[model samples]
Target: MKGYLKAHTHFFLPSEQMAEYLDLPEKTSYSALPPAGDSNQVLPLPDSALTLFYVGGIGAHYKLNAFIDAARSIPQIRVNLVTRKKQWDEAIASYPTFQSPQIHPYHLNANELDDLYAQSHIGVLAVEPSDYRRFAVPLKLFEYLSRGRPILVTEGTEAARIVSSFNAGWVVPYTAEAIAATLRRLQGNRAEVQAKAANAVSAAKVNTWADRARTVADTLTGKSK
Candidate 1:
């Protein structure tokens, strides 16, 4: 397979073992889109309530229930979840934490989701720890960075590593306690939050879809070493 294929492309690495086994020429890329908002836009430190935004599928693997529970415990923190009605219903039924007033669930279109990202203070991605998650980078992570939102991602995922490397957000255990504690810390340190948000914007500049495309093109064309 390696001999026949010119190159092996991946949205993100599959796994260390798989990469070693394939031993093929590899080009790694991210499924990032151009930022919806202005990358130069400076987000002021939150003086009021800190809002956490999440926009995507509400599958069980996302571990959104933990976020909801954390939000329920933190009255000062606001959570906005944009997803389908069916998923929302299931989540609310399964996790009573969704009943908390701090948790605001909405079904929105692309434009609305973008608007929500602009309004929110932080982005949350609490994926469950799994083999698939270890290497996969969720598209929402890039979108959050592009929109200049500091992220709160679960530890041990590719997204967490990227966020940490870029200093764009907090990476912690996938638990309600950890989420709530991080939110409290961020709420207390507005300056840190602002710094992380700024870092996220900077990361977006390099990780945008156009930049990633050019990198892939360069690799294929033998223009990149």
Candidate 2:
């Protein structure tokens, strides 16, 4: 596989950490190309209170409890937990906080996610830290960026770098204290959220399908090779 990769004209990788796995030479280095988003997404203002949105798994690995724990500190703020109905039911059965009024759970189609994002301020991606996660960028991060919602991701992950690079959102560790502090500090700070959201939207612009295509074309043609 190393020989095959070395012989290739060019190799594109989402993150530089992946380069370590290949151990290729410096000349035939892998290009960094993370995921992109659609520009047609509806952009909306941040909510009055710092509203949070997350769509995906909710089990222990998903770190739903951590988000809930943080949200508990800010009574006014709400956390939108969108996931499978069965998962929600099971979670609700185990965690009493899942039934709290501050936590809103929904099972909606992919298109309906925009409506949810429309009313939210930050998009949460509480992925557990690992070498794979360190390099991998989740698609939902871009989805949040596309809708002008500031991202909320854990540190030591590639997504965190994207958020920092774009000034698109907060990159706190996946801990109750860290998340709560961020929420409490920005609670009801609509202007700050609005400002960062603009950056996120701008960041999304450069990560659109058209932009990705042009980048690939340029790389293939040796313009950036």
Clashes of each: 0, 0
Clashing pairs in 1: none
**Tens digit of lDDT per residue, candidate 1, span 97-149?**
67778988899886667556666888988756776677666778877887788
TM-score of 1: 0.83
* Deviating ranges (above 4 Å) for candidate 1: 1-47
Local accuracy by lDDT, each model: 0.73, 0.81
For candidate 2, write residues 1-225 as lDDT tens digits. Answer: 667665775777887777887787777756888888898784777435667899888776565677688887678888887899988888878987768778888899888776678779889886666677788878888888888888888898888988999998988887889989988878756677878888988898888978888988998887974
- Candidate with maximal TM-score: 2
- Which 10-residue window of candidate 2 scores lowest in summed lDDT? 42-51
In angstroms, how far off is 135's CA in candidate 2?
Answer: 0.7
